[model samples]
Target: MGDRWQVEVDRGVCIGSGMCVNHAPAGFTLDSARQSHPREPETDANEPLLTAAEGCPVEAITITLLTTGEAVFPPEE
Candidate 1:
């Protein structure tokens, strides 16, 4: 099976911080007022989505790999 990664952000926990967007622009973006949601193109397995997740001060990002059911969290500084 092809590999895929799913990303999720907890809106309630999101603090309108743009760190994720800044860290992984290709994988994330902020709304007009800097509200965070998943990016449209989707995140690549090797992309910096993990970094963005770690950059989030609120720890609101979650990444799950579909094929192996593996996951990465809290990007390392």
Candidate 2:
């Protein structure tokens, strides 16, 4: 666990598309609700995680740099 990044899933915004799971199964899973959820919020920063977040059709996944408190995914406004 590098603990440098914070990954989150917005269940309300998730469309249950399973793209995140397909991209990064170790970090994301589709719960019984069929929504994507984080299994390891502070896992080592990786490319798949970013890809998973970016690939979300609904942009439900959010990845933030813990050190800087800056969102790396979903392109924060």
Among these predictions, the greatest TM-score belongs to 2
**Local error of candidate 1 at 8, Å?**
0.7
User: Which residue runs of candidate 1 sit more than 4 Å off their true CA positions?
Assistant: 1-3, 74-77
Candidate 2: C-alpha lDDT: 0.88
lDDT of 2 by residue, 4-55 (tens): 8899998998999999999988889888889888888877789999999999
TM-score of each: 0.76, 0.89
Candidate lDDT values, in order: 0.75, 0.88
Candidate 1 C-alpha lDDT tens digits along 1-77: 44577788888898987898888888777778667888843446755777888789999888777555566664334
- Model 1 Cα RMSD, Å? 3.6
**What 10-residue stretch in candidate 2 is worst by lDDT?**
1-10
In model 1, what are the clashing residue pairs, if there are any?
A: none
Worst 10 residues of 1 by lDDT: 68-77
